[model samples]
Target: MRIAFLLALLAGGVYYTYVAFIDLNFLTRTGRLGPGFFPRSVGVMIVLLTIWALVDALKEGREAATNAGLWRDVAMLMVLAIIYAVALRVFGGFVATVLYLAVTLSVLNRGRPLQNALLSILVPVAVYLLFDRVLNASMPPGLIDILPI
Candidate 1:
């Protein structure tokens, strides 16, 4: 499973690297810093991290056993992320992210309502402020737009 996780990460890293290369045009149109600069940097980082993860997995395979169900956790996280993506466009970032965090934490930590609620609300609000205010990025308004906040 660890090997599988490493392989998946490596594959994703490679795919993103390819995408970053293709997206270079978007970055080159502007000044020295292009739109692809950040994404390419991220791709490079992912590639390095995936390589490191693969090495660690190989070393651990030879050493003591490690049964953390890393793949299962990853799968669950992916599903939650997909849910959040779909919900974000339809339900808005706040609602989608809250639901995603709530569901993911509940599944992972066995449904602690107080903890889940806190995480769900706090994380989305923080992200909203960061992206909307700090980064000046646009996000879907969703149903919440009806209510004046």
Candidate 2:
């Protein structure tokens, strides 16, 4: 099971790396890297780590499957990610990010609603400020683009 999961992750990482290389536009070079820079870097890292993890898990034998828990949380998280991708364009980065962050935090920190709520609000806002103000990177401002941003 662990091997299977690792293989699945490796496949996903490879697909994303392919997408990164192909889809994103290269900004005319200035001081900063192109739009694909971060995604390409992350894709490579994901592929490398997934490969390492798969190799390590295979070497450790099949005992991992017996010790591992059910796939409920994993399934739920995957569902959430799918929803987030759909919501991202319609709701824009801030709203989509906040919603995704809140839900993920709620799921991961089940007993701490207060922490989840606070982080849901704080994290996205901080990220927005850092990226938009400091880094000068634009986020998808979808729908009511004028207000929150």
- Write down the lDDT of every candidate, Cα atoms only: 0.79, 0.85
lDDT of 2 by residue, 25-93 (tens): 445367467888888999999999999988898788866343234477777889999998877877888
Model 2 lDDT, residue 27, Cα: 57
Writing each residue's lDDT as its tens digit, candidate 1 over 24-78 gives 6444554567767888889989999889888888987764565569867887799
Clash count of each predicted structure: 2, 0
lDDT of 2 at 44: 95
**Model 1 misplaced regions, further than 4 Å:** 1-68, 143-149
TM-score of each: 0.48, 0.53
Cα lDDT, model 2, residue 117 = 95
Determine which window of 10 residues in candidate 1 has minimal summed lDDT: 140-149
